[model samples]
Target chain A: MSKLISCYRGAVDAWECDQMGHMNVQFYMAKGSEAFAHLQNALGLDPARIRKEKRGLRFKSLRTQYKSEVHAGSALHGIAGIRKLDGDVIHGFIQLFETAFDRLSAVYEFTALYTNLQTDEALPLPGDLRDRALALADDHPDIYQPAPFVGTVMPARPLKHMFESSRSSVDVWECDIFNHIEHRHIVGYFSDAATHIMGSVGLTRHTVRSRNLGSAALDYYSEFHAPIKMSTPVLLKSGLMGAKGKIFRFGHHLFDLDSGEIAISTTVLGCYFDMTARKSVPLPEEYANFPAEKVLAKQL
Target chain B: MSGYVESYRGQVLASECDLLGHMNIQFYISRLSQAIWNMCYFVGMAPEEIKGSKRALATVHQDSNYLSELMAGDIIHMETAVLKASTKTITFRHRLINSATGDPALTNISTVAYMDLTARKAIPLTEAMKIKVNELMVDAEDEA
Candidate 1:
């Protein structure tokens, strides 16, 4: 039998759709968060065990690729499997598919490490947990694996010229039982920050609407350096990484206000599309006109 | 017998849990609410048709038994089967199972009807719809 385990099944609700008429990126992350729970259970980290032990798997890094769009009322299901285990870190993948067409919708490639729920400290995987994960690890030659992310990836250190895109404090309702912010809400911050990032480059909401254009992230790569806890004031600094042809890359550095430490670094690759046609279009003139010295890609 | 098909499979979110430290009752109903659409699709009423014709299944009554508590980060899924189908209504059962323990978290019996949205009245099932729903019927004893 295939080592892949079924993880998520559900349909997209109308409210989950954005102006582009497809499920928003945040909701995609939400479904992925659900699938991640199942992945943990498969590794013997059931809810009861995690609650009793106060420890569980925390993401070290994750990459998501939006393959196809699913709209309101479209049914979706997901399957996940371990790709490999490297010492204390476990690498895995999850794919969500459109049930009706049996076509790929999104893919999540992630690496996680055992962590203390309260302290956000990385811990060595227990013997039993390690064995369970090692047993499930497979190089599944049949499954699809994304190629190495093209262009530059965000580094852990803060880069110059990045400007604040979002400022918010974590709310109790947005946290998991561990008091750490959940994955979906973390991505939601990125989603909301998109508008501000665009505004910094002269592509404000009014400008995009007037142009009848919408933006979509084709790929996103995020690296977690520290845990973002409840009620913590956080700020996201973003800068244009590069822009050419139909694609533009933006980079983000999420920092904790109290410690002033960069908590997460993310690189987003995306493009603008005609809202009516839903097809990719060339980057706006402003993208080409942005000062090259200010682009983070230059710093990288 | 292929009488029960997988309907809803997902995880329990922390926000869905109440002060009791378990998934709240409304979320259980919410999941079953989604399952109804899936179950309806298996019973010959596709979501597309429902959206296009403005004719869809609306649960008029349901009986629920919360067999176990599902905590945050727990994975669960539902296996649903048609219990009864008639000209005016369809009765189905969904057994929501905890994935790790393989135990039922909630068992829900829902009776829904195909209704005309504009008229707001229950409608009869066509002959084809009857055959599909009948194909999925399970004797009450068959339910686990």
Candidate 2:
């Protein structure tokens, strides 16, 4: 196996933390994106060459897992290695570590397609570039582990039982220059639905304060299927997937109301907590009897 | 399956976009957080009730997929529904759509647990509140 190479080194910024008091998920993506660019450079696919050739890489899919929390002032670095190459596509892996304690903080796996910018068509890597990429290809088991739901193929079957949880129109503030919705907002949409669902079950701030309890997410996985444009009417559908002990899982589907196509799929894992004790706890009687199987039966 | 209820509406601002010129992922989550509050209020668990009861929902995990892109100046709306409600936690799904194209820009799924701010422990929904919550469940027979 080829050796891993350093791709990015930086410090966590104070501004990156969210209300939950840890680094927000978007910053993790930003860091991984930068590392991917550096890895491309290491493979000799520099910006100048790509610009001259009118060729570039487009992200086809991404999977990330937050293993540990990083606080502001935490020095961080990323190491990357090529995993596989097939024709015009490249699969890569990156590992992020906090330098202070030298602990793994997160992992990212991504697939990118080489494309002719002018024609927007997939193209194979040049012979020389392919050789260079292969020279650096490695799958270090100690440094990387497969994240759940990364390889799960979305079923093509149509949704049977779905609830329209939230409906919203795109706003100018939510779009990037490419006129596409930003990644952070996609997560925002999911969060909105989660809040509504929790409220529907009396798990609101009012109830929490009265009960001395709280909630927190343990992990997440998402898959992108299509692209959406500005000012499009969107629909989101959701259902229960399953549960194990204190952990519960849920699924969501995003649709473009205009095209009537499924655009995105997402899953989340979460846990209950005791605020005073600051530890995970069991479900209360009121919430313990949810018909998980009934809900799962309705999932697309 | 619950029917969708209109939860929140807003316009995207230019400031929310990243260097790629698309909306930043964090903003999407922030807006959804706002919508959750709106839905809570609509369901009779307004801020006043929260303040009086000292209970709140805290997200434990959230997953999102960006299917389409939305640019600045796009008017966005969000709809939310309950996916599951268990003893300690509940899951929700949200959809964001662009008004001009009438297409879904993104979809999100999130799970949260009820919390007691003072004790910081997981709690159960009251029997009375559970009955009210059942009202939010979608009628499985209804088609989208």
Candidate 3:
């Protein structure tokens, strides 16, 4: 087992926390993305050299699982290691720890392609860079194990019904300099869809607040299929996957309205929370029958 | 896979790019989500209808693959096809193409379920809605 590279260290800021009183999903992704760049630098792919060579990395896929909640003012330490190196693609994982609690908060797994920026073609990792990457390769199996859903391939099945849950046109404020929506906003869309779904299930903010309970995502897996242009109108669809005990799973699809294509797919596992206790709680009686796979099949 | 129906289109703007000089991952997700709303409207499930009836769709799972890089000033064209449709759920596949190159840049698969807001439970698709879904359905094998 190689040593884990200490890639990033930071703190959870007040602004990063959401209504659930913990750092939001987007912030986690942002930090993880930053750590990815740091890992590249550690592997000798310095930004200046990359730019000079007209070379860059494109993220092909990402999967994240939240194991514990991090609150504002919590100290954060991100450790990363190369999981695999295949020609132009780098497969890696990052573990985020809340130093204050001495507990792991999240894990991020990603696949990125090293490419020639001008031609947009993949390039093999140079020998020296590969050596550096290898030095940082570590499999800390004892400290972290991926969630069961991390790489689960969703079954391909026919749709019985589809509903358009939300619609919004991209605005300048919503985009970054790359001429596309930022990673945070992509997760934000999923968050929005989840909120809407919860609302449909009588788990709205008001209801949750009144009941002193809320919902929190335990795991989030998303894929970026394509980039959405600025000023484009986008659509969102959401639905339930399953529910058991206090855990509820859901999915979302974002499409480019004009082209009629899917741009992203996300799966989220969430749990009911007792806000005061800052811990998970059982599903409410009213929501106990919330559609599970059996109910969904029956409806179909 | 048979063939996709045009779903959405738009131009990449300077602001959408990141410091890396390419479109960010989030924008792709946003655009595709907008297209889904349009599809619902096309199938007669307008936002107003959903709101009035207190019925909504919720996402259960989504998977996507980014095939190519897209930059500022590029025009994006997206197409969508129904992969599967059931009484309470629908699965869809979307492909995004760069107008300039006419090559696919991304593909995504998503599954969703219909729900009754008041009852807070999954609901069956109406016969009318099911017919529209069937009309848009395409076999994945056909795309090959």
Candidate 4:
């Protein structure tokens, strides 16, 4: 009951930080995930063995709480412990800490299911696997409810921009190893479309230096009420959620157009960048010259 | 090794391809990683051996490009060549190959650095390790 894995340490790189000089939220989870994978290998339960043994675990949901910002150049460490194991479900607690100063920066708790790798459905853990996991859970017993932003489906809001053309499908090549579309791909879709829209407004990347500030995403969240098979057409719906001064929040939903179901919902917290001073800049006055209603009516 | 150790393999599964099947993207990386790890062990950098020396190769930057589709039952071979070596970094270029017909599957480049986990930063590679790696590099090149 006293098995405690040593902490996994990873240094924050310059590329991992955003323009805001803070570690990007997506990267924070990425670091934890890296540690988790290594931990599995250390447990003698690497993926190949799992595949060959016909047993695997899939992440069902995660609740992450951002306690403090981790700036670039910080040495980040993660301490993971099994919190609870119920039948086929294992809940884990991971704390991201600044190792140099010993300060807690972020906490992530995840719900995962033991399943047949070939079937992707919740299944009972193999007797030996369950025994090992139970031993770990018993040693560390601090269990808490997952955070709000983890697994909950995002609200489906209507689009604010009025655009006539819609993109029906995304190229298959853009999908990353996760089978789920990569996070950057989602941003790429809108960023590319934004450039075109900005063209109508007579703006270019060189003309206006804008930057993404912060973003929140639910990796496993699907808007579709039903299963979405891969390679199926995923229709995207984009809209402006709100804007205040220079700060704007945008919402996006990717759905199965044929099934009329949602596949992914994303909320972006971003701002216009001055690019010169490298500071947050307000939305340029040039935007006022464009037809706000036309640009903000339908999903862009 | 001063020169890279050349090894080759193909991709039989990819992340998005799992959408139609049961495998996930994580597994794809995991399998490729195993192949690489096994090769490294064959070259004398097994985890236990590295742990005995209180040193390990830590991954710093890894970027993967998926070029072609890999379906189940496809045979993929990976060829790895050391690109450069320094006190801290070991750069390798890996090519994924299709063994059935012999074609490229994917290309990935990874930069790993020698790390002292206790201190947690880049450190110099041991001279003995360097000599052994170079020996393996010579053997691999000679075989090629």
**lDDT per prediction?**
0.88, 0.65, 0.69, 0.53
Candidate 1: give the clashing pairs. Answer: none
Q: State the lDDT at B23 in candidate 3.
A: 86
Which candidate gets the maximum lDDT versus the true structure? 1
Task: For candidate 4, write residues A222-283 as lDDT tens digits.
Answer: 23232234466765565544455664444556666776765555544455554345455666
Q: Looking at model 4 chain A, report the run of 10 residues with the lowest lDDT sum.
A: A213-222
Minimum summed lDDT over a 10-residue window in model 1 chain A is located at A68-77
Query: What does candidate 2's lDDT look like per residue over B1-144, in tens digits?
Result: 454655544445556667886788888887677555444543334344453446656788888888777654455667777666788676667788664456888778777777776788878866654654566655433423
Model 2 residue B94 distance off true place after TM-score fit, in angstroms = 44
Interface RMSD of 4: 11.6
Please, what are the lDDT tens digits per residue for candidate 3 over residues B18-114?
A: 8887789898886676456546544446444452547656678899999988775455667888888877988888888775567788999888777
lDDT of 2 at A7: 62
Error of 1 at B87 (Å): 2.9
Q: List-wise, what DockQ does each model earn?
A: 0.60, 0.04, 0.04, 0.06
Q: What is the lDDT of residue B84 in candidate 1?
A: 89
For model 3 chain B, the run of ten residues with the poorest summed lDDT = B42-51
Root-mean-square deviation of every model: 2.0, 19.8, 22.4, 11.7
- Cand. 4 Cα-lDDT: 0.53
Candidate 1: stretches off by over 4 Å: B50-55, B115-128, B141-144
Best by DockQ: 1
The sequence of per-residue lDDT tens digits that candidate 1 reaches over residues B35-96 is 77666667787656654546778899999999999988788999888888878899988899
